[model samples]
Target: MSDLLARHRAVMPNWLALYYDEPIEIVSGKGNRVVDASGKSYLDFFAGILTNMIGYDVPEVREAVERQLATGVVHTSTLYLMRGQIELAEKIARLSGIPDAKVFFTNSGTEANETALLLATYARRSDQVLAMRQSYHGRSFGAVGVTSNRAWKNSSLSPLNVHFLHGADRHLTPFRGMSDADYVAACVEDLRHVLSTVVGGDVATLIAEPIQGVGGFTMPPDGLFAAYREVLDAEGVLFISDEVQTGWGRTGSAFFGIQNHGVTPDMMTFAKGLGNGFAVGGVVARGDLMDGLHAVGLSTFGGNPVSMAAANATLDYVLDHDLQANAARTGALIVDGLREAAPRLPIVGDVRGKGLMFALDLVDPATGAPAPALAARFMEETRKAGLLAGKGGLYGNVLRMAPPLTLTVEEAAEGLGIIVDALETVNAEVTS
Candidate 1:
């Protein structure tokens, strides 16, 4: 181990942990592969929690950064305008197909979400913000207030008028007996009930991830959004779609994830894949909503020239290379492979995802309950076998396989093989 690694473990507080850190220290990356300090390579299926859509160190992105550096890095301030920032804003707006929408950039997903929450609340002059249960919206003060996961909240709890709707966990209740259409209708009704009972007129906005990424890759039944939109519109509540984990071609779609469901939101937050690993995030809002927040919020490094340049390059690459369509094609292949292998593995419970973002839920073979320990063991075993995977879900039983959009078909197959091997090992251990 490196001296720095030893120093880190000695000095760092283990209580502040987030992820289950692997022993290997990643030193470098190229395309879909990451190399550790010891020079061992691992096929990167994690993709920095689904942030690196374009893979690592793409020449075009590197060239763009180099060109920006040559011209001197542009700092973000309220005082000036940078060309790169303007270009990226325009490009994103055009691609989003929202002719009058405006963009406010941030350095990370949490900040972008914080901005959206602030704007939604301030504009509507209400304190209540409704979010779906089992959703993972970042972990900042305001973002954490809206996030549905209590486990992630830790001890930093505060008083906030945040309401929860039972959308993602609906499968566990009366929703399980309903058809898809009826389930969605019931979800929308629940949203309305939450607003009426808990939120009331104080409700300023309702935010949700179109596809619950960290909440076990839960897919909302069709017509749910349309129903929710109708209710929000009627009640004059702002609808904010947190697309931090699903935007920018991850869902095999263009722009925001809501587009796939055939409904638009009053505000949309994006990060993760936006800069393709270069640390960029932003909030796009409807024209009316945006016009109200023109001078209220600001960030120092929100839309700096270098970050904007990286975002522009990423957007261009996604479109010019047709990566969105590729995600659909490749994602289908991987999902089908998992389905075919599911029956052979007793630990496998469910497979659900869209595009490059997918999850395989592991369950106890006997009780059919979520098996978080088994999932963690599988992740460790997979990493040992040179495949990098992530664990998600409220129970932490969903093996999140959100690789880079640039992952080739062969690479997907190879990564899946490691997962299969890990499952076999886990099953054997349980049996023994």
Candidate 2:
């Protein structure tokens, strides 16, 4: 190990234990590839946890940043209106299909989610929020309260009235097994039961990730969002969709995750791909809810000029280049390839996701149980072999592949090949 690594290990706080230590020191990135200090190139499938929608070091994004620098105006308080912020807000509202929606910008996903939660709580004047089990909203205090992952909540045992809902339950699998009508009905019934029995009327907002990105990339059953909307509507609870990971065309969609289920959420939080790796996030809410919080809500760094300019450029590039469609097409190819390869590997349990976000569940060949250790080994081996993939799920058994939307088919294939090779190596070692 280098002296830098040794020093980091000795002095860094223990909270950084969540990430694995790699030998290589990545110095630069471009498109879907990253280069280490020694000029070794690696395919980056993780895309910084699905934040880099336009890939690394895109010329457009870089140019936008440079132009903002040239203007000598980077940061400004929301007390004064700025042209860049205004344009970016307008663009986001237009692209989100919610023209009248009001937006509150932030510097990160957690902040955006926190803003959404505060707005939701204020709007309904309720203390409780309902979130799904295995779902990850963010790591901040307010957002962490709603997250169901036990490991993430271990340190801060903050009090929160959060009810867990079973997501994409195979028993009620919509579009996977039953007819569309039956699937939709089952989902509706499930939501109704959760609302009346589990959450009741105490819930102020029901937050959900459209595709459950960190929760194993689990796609909710068809019409599930519509069902949840109905339940929330009946209870007069705000529906907040946390699109921190699944937004910004990463899921092959133009806007929020709720759109995939053909339902509109009362409030939406976006961050990951909003500025294409730049520090930017937003909380978009319905006109009524937004108006309710206008008096109390304030963020000093939100909607700054530089971040807004970057976001504007990102939105333009995404739309003009049809990156969402590209994600849809490339993602289909990757999923099909994985399906074709799954039969050859007995440990391959399941494959799920959409657009550029996908996951592969590793299992024990003999017992068909989740093999988290094997997944860890696969990540290590793949990283050694020049690919960067991530692990998700409560057990960390899901291999998460969320490459940038700009990733080409050839790059996707190369990344998948690395994964296949790593899986085979781990499986062989286990059998031996």
Candidate 3:
């Protein structure tokens, strides 16, 4: 490890995960790349966990934050109305399909999910919630309660009575071999049975990520959530889409990942890319649900002027450039390229995802077992090849790639080539 990495390990929590055996401290970034302390450039495929939506050093976002800094009012609590905050909220409300929507800002996805859960429980007067298996929301106690992943759930103690559901992850399910229509039907049946038999009472809400981010970029069959929405309507359970990883057109086909499911959520929480790396997150809810919280609440740093300005400028760039269209176009190319290349690679078992959000599951070529060690080796090799990707899964065998929406076809091809080369190199070494 380098000196900086040693310093980081000495002071930081041991539980805090870092990529690579010897973590490289990135000191500078440009459009689609970052330079480490050693002055080595690496193509940034993960884009800071998909937070840098536009790319590094985006002029609009930087200028907006710079302008806010010049104003000299860094923060004033939610008691004061700031123009940037109001404007950003309006933009979010317009984008959110919930009827008479209202926006409550937070400092991160964890807080956004926390606020949504609070609104949900208060509105329905129930602490019971439904969540998906292999799902991860945030690290907070409340968020962890609903998170079903064993690796991320550090504690069994939870504030809410959370139940895990099935169907989000095809790989982990016994029904993976079934056709899409049959698979969705099976999962929907399970959800209904769970609601009727397990809880049998008021379930405040069913919260799910459109694409299970940390659960290895796993996705359910299309229209699965829509089927669940029908059940939620009958059972009087609200729906919350945790779009922290899938929002702002990152999914390539939809501006919001829930759109692909063909159902509008009662409430939605977003973070990650909205502010393009600035600390910003929020919950958008229907008017009644939002107003149901009788207790007074205020976020200290939520929707502060700087974050609001950053979000405003970022959203403007996203909309003006029609980055969603680009995501669909180039994302299709990347997916097709990966699918075509997977046949030639021995370790790759699956390639799945939408738009820019894609994942490759590594497995033992002979036995078809998850190869997490191979995944780790490949990650280091990818870094050495000057490309940065992310790894996830309950088994830690999935390679995730979600480059900025602004990635050109040329960049996509270049990065995918590097990935293919890394896979080939690792395959040779592992087999040798």
Give the best candidate by TM-score.
Answer: 3
Candidate 1 lDDT score relative to the true structure: 0.81
Candidate 2 weakest ten by summed lDDT = 167-176
Q: Candidate 1: lDDT of 209? A: 93
Query: What's the CA RMSD for each of the models?
Result: 2.0, 2.6, 1.0
Clashing pairs in 1: none
Clashes in candidate 3: how many?
0
Q: Write the per-residue lDDT of candidate 3 for residues 46-88, one digit (tens) a residue.
A: 9999999889999989999999999899998899988998998
List candidate 1 segments past 4 Å from native.
16-22, 74-76, 155-159, 294-297
In model 2, the clashing pairs are none
In the range 183-269, model 1's lDDT, one tens digit per residue, is 877788788778667655667988899888778788786557778888888888888888888887877855567887788787889
Q: Is candidate 1 or candidate 3 better by lDDT?
A: 3
lDDT of 3: 0.91
lDDT tens per residue, model 2, 356-386: 8899999898988789988888888987899
**What is the clash count of model 2?**
0
Candidate 3 residue pairs in backbone clash: none
- The parts of candidate 2 lying over 4 Å away from their true place are 18-23, 155-159, 169-187, 198-202
Q: Choose 1 or 3, whichever is better by TM-score.
A: 3
